[model samples]
Target: MERDLSCSWRARREAGGHAKGGKVTSSDVIMVPQIIPTDSVSVGRAATLALRCTMCHGARGMSEAYTPNLAGQNAEVVYKQLRDLQLGHRKSAIMGLHARNLSDQDMRGLAAYYSYLLRETPPSSLLGQRKAPRIIQVGSPMFNIAPCASCHGGSARKTASSTLEGEPENYIRAQLSAFKDGTRHNDINGQMRSVARQMTPEKVETLAKYYSQR
Candidate 1:
């Protein structure tokens, strides 16, 4: 089955990277099959390349700052994000500079290597997901919003959705705010934007605190 790229990235590229007011995450490259190459060369290249990434993402792929952790992150998700940055579909000052010079193989290799690392365990202080707010566990269907867990809770997640468990509260809040304000429209099919738009700022704060510190 083929995916459509006419919406944003493809159109932008075809229009010489100047398609105005219709940007989206550049997931067009993964429309077909999505697989990370684990071959020795690819892995070695990725490992070597990761030397530059470790400054922010930690030597093991977990960041000490508010940045997203790359350890055990979904390979496809990481790959798409990098591609988006390279294609100007996503905006990040630091990442854009780094991804600007990365080749296709470099991106794939980096993504595969990061996913190969072990994930950091959540701290004991973190609260149980069961005790989360009603909107986080079971969304308000009256507003047509699905549970945050449906896509970001780390189980049976939708394609291309990022994992939110054990993430930084500040980071989660910022991204949620971005989505709510349409600043982060990279989410596939506007799923995140739609969900965030319906949530109140207070609800966003609550959700962030629950997912991060509980």
Candidate 2:
């Protein structure tokens, strides 16, 4: 699996012409062509043409390790993140480059494409409780941390915030860490940063596991 993943990324890099051995300049960024018109209902097709997104994010939008799964996410959340990447409200070496050439309409089209996909696996409790995760039930009032469910809806729905029930563990952990360290500040009014700053590593791990298991 590791080798296959490496090969997949390598192929994508080579396809982007980044394999040329030289300092990466601003002009080296790859720009995929938009195929479908924005007014059409073929936004998914357009996104596939503009960005072979499935090369990194799975075909069905299930993601591996550091990539957050986009399946069943709110279109608004996905579009906002892409916009943030493009506008520098969020920072990512790869995503920023990919987003730099995208227009607002393109971002929305791509978001719509991913948001409608289904997850590889439905989330379930590791202990078979079929109930909310423990962290969702209890929050540390001492740190002014509200229950996650308070912000993220309890059901399988997405809001301005992401739908976290089935996100990748490492992705969630990394984002939490970013928020804690002040590197990811896209959350409105620093809400995530505030919560993450008050959370310990252990708490972050627990939350990641709990949510990933759903």
Candidate 3:
């Protein structure tokens, strides 16, 4: 059955002018039919991926601590990260092995699946009442280290490139720490590293708490 399916796909490709060894033209790049199998095996694999992912990422991708909340993350970003883990660009003992077993289709499906999850909003009071040490205030005056909203706020804010409305605070802090310690120095633009280095331990905790509350 699999061989038959492969032959059929090949035939369709040839019909669309995609010859095995011939020079390809722009018109030959027609859309191929999506061939995801709706069998028990596929469903089981997807279910397993969801279950395994939930253990660390959270039931619906809303983690309580350090683990990144994958709910509502950009699908492309998630997909690329999975690919990076598989390629060794991203280092994770567990994630690298897990990503290795996943096909491109599986990665895309997982990305799409997690991206659709609804993000949980944190309490406003928690964000409003969080206090920080006085030194952070004087040290990082440029970015407003205490109040997370200072840099992560309105359209005109310093880091207004992306919205931090529903992201996981644990993930945010992890990235910041990674930047500071140089464990995750893959950021070519250097914006994240710069921000992370400027933040003290107190400031990281303060912002993490404040963002999590929001």
Candidate 4:
């Protein structure tokens, strides 16, 4: 299909004709199919890549404290982060090295590979969908904290924001701590920092455990 498309596109370009009836433009480039199908990035291949990635992140994209778990995360999110790292918008020595060498296809493949991984759910999740913990469900009005569920996709729905369900507990704890300390300011308008600032240490730990178990 790709070969045929390429040939057709070349023929059209050489003939100086528009694409069928419509005008041809750079946007038409998207009409060309990728050499590799998105579905070809399988779990096994992802795991193999993860092995190369396991020094800091685990074999399943589960990393230690302060590292993110890539399993079951949104593919676009992963792709954007990789792009950011490559462009120096985000800073991480390890990620910068990995992203710098990757082509656009590699980023997409990695995204698809990690997005499809199956994460283990806690027993509570098996029973049924669960609600966010009280702290996440109801924001502290006095402190001007927004409800975490509103933006993080809540416990009931997965949002474009990173999915926290079944992620490593330590990672969540560390991130919240970072947000509180103003060390991590990636969130737009300092939203995470604001929310974390209002949360006590005990509350932060509670929120971490609540989502980790889900």
Number of the predicted model whose TM-score against the real structure is largest: 1
**Model 4 agreement with the true structure over 57-120: per-residue lDDT tens digits:** 6777766666777877866557656755675444578888988987766766677778777665
Candidate 1 residue lDDT tens string, 1-214: 2222222223123233342465433434334134567788888889999999888888998776478888888777788789778876677999999999998779878877887888776555655444878887899898888988888776668666676765678888888888888776667767777998898888888888776653
> lDDT values of the candidates?
0.73, 0.67, 0.57, 0.64
Please report, as a residue range, the 10-residue window in candidate 3 with the lowest summed lDDT: 1-10
Residue pairs clashing in model 3 are: none
**Candidate 3, 1-214: lDDT as tens digits:** 1111111111112225443566432223322223433345653566568788887888887766667777765454466567657755457899888899998778766765666678777566755575543432343566533333444455434411233555567777887888787676434344556778878777777666555665
- Give stretches of model 4 more than 4 Å off: 1-37, 41-48, 64-66, 125-131, 154-159
What ranges in model 1 sit over 4 Å off? 1-33, 123-130
- What TM-scores do the predictions have? 0.80, 0.74, 0.60, 0.68
Candidate 2 lDDT at 108 equals 65
Best by lDDT: 1
List candidate 2 segments past 4 Å from native: 1-40, 123-127, 130-134, 155-158
Ranking by lDDT: 1, 2, 4, 3
Q: Rank the candidates by TM-score, best first.
A: 1, 2, 4, 3
- Residue 7 error for model 1, in Å? 16
The alpha-carbon deviation from the true structure for residue 191 of candidate 2, after best TM-score superposition, in angstroms, is 0.3
